[model samples]
Target: MGKNIDDYIDKGLKGTPETKPSERREYLSQLRERIILALTNGQVIQQKPYKPISDLMKRYPSSKLYLDGDLDYMHLSKYIRIANENNIPFTIVDDKASSTNIGLVLANPTAIDKDDIFVSREEFQRHL
Candidate 1:
């Protein structure tokens, strides 16, 4: 006879130990490297837009929005308008913030120009 579903569930319910800080740091470093390689090799990373400008501003009151240099003019204008409406400060910068508390990154690969020298994920990590 096959094992009951409850048996499998019971086994799965046994939680594993949490990752140590050092191990987590190493894993994150490796993940960062992989992402950088992918970006440098012409890969695009699509991040899901999660929060509204107002919510984000409220959460990180001190954060400045760093707009990518190659962002589309129309989108940039829209973001600026939204920021203004929400009373959030922002700037166009070559580098993105490494820490979330300091700044928010807004980059759209489709909006980038072919001739523009876009910063790679690796460079951003180094700045962090």
Candidate 2:
């Protein structure tokens, strides 16, 4: 009972414990298993938007788009347009403390447990 009280107090003081906080920070507040697609900061700034992202957005209307606020809005604007066009909700994760290269993540509220969540530029070109 004493331990339980201490734990409750700790929770109240520090907020609730999160699972895999580093991974969450890297993946823009979403778990790896829940991400349907992830793009690096460079990838998100490419001359053209990746087609697979639009396709995935169309396929997963229930999914949400997470954009890194660390990047310039110009880099994220294209995706924001895609999300709006798809009618999917989006959030900009602007954590200055987060040191991740990932710039965009499309995740379902529930875990989908996908093994391949990243699309490389080579893969995108081959598919194009």
Candidate 3:
């Protein structure tokens, strides 16, 4: 059909379409619904790791950790250590093409539709 041909041509010309490109950029290439936890660059840079993150990793052992490759490894290493301790797979997303304020994300491959994925600074501090 003409529409099918157009679709194929479009795909060839523009590459495959991505869902919620902006959201993915903001969440370090993961969908919002799939994220179990997200931390801002500032949060990740704190001297201590967010306390609940370790527990969350234990709760969702199958989840993957996405760290912003833009930051130095020292800023990200605490969480990386936790991921290693929990056996949660981790990735450093070096998305030079896009800029994001989010420095870390813990997410599943499938959508979890979690409503409270971001931890407020107050809650994070209290947990620490």
Instruction: Note the Cα lDDT for every prediction shown.
Output: 0.39, 0.90, 0.93
Q: What are the C-alpha RMSDs, in order, of all predicted structures?
A: 14.9, 1.3, 1.5
Question: What C-alpha lDDT does candidate 1 achieve relative to the native structure?
Answer: 0.39
lDDT of 1 by residue, 12-126 (tens): 8975445353422332212221121112212111232222445655654554445443444444565566567666676754433221111224322122223433345555344
Winner of 1 and 2 under TM-score:
2
My TM-score estimates for the predictions, one after another, are 0.34, 0.93, 0.90
**Model 2 Cα displacement at 31 (Å)?**
0.5
Off by over 4 Å in 1: 1-51, 94-128
* lDDT, candidate 2, 102-128, per-residue tens: 999999989899999988779866654
lDDT of 3 by residue, 12-125 (tens): 999999999999999999999999999999999998999888888888878999999999999999999999999999999999999998999999888899998888888878
Q: How accurate is candidate 2 locally (lDDT)?
A: 0.90
In candidate 1, how many Å is residue 124 off? Answer: 23
Between prediction 1 and prediction 3, the one with superior lDDT is 3
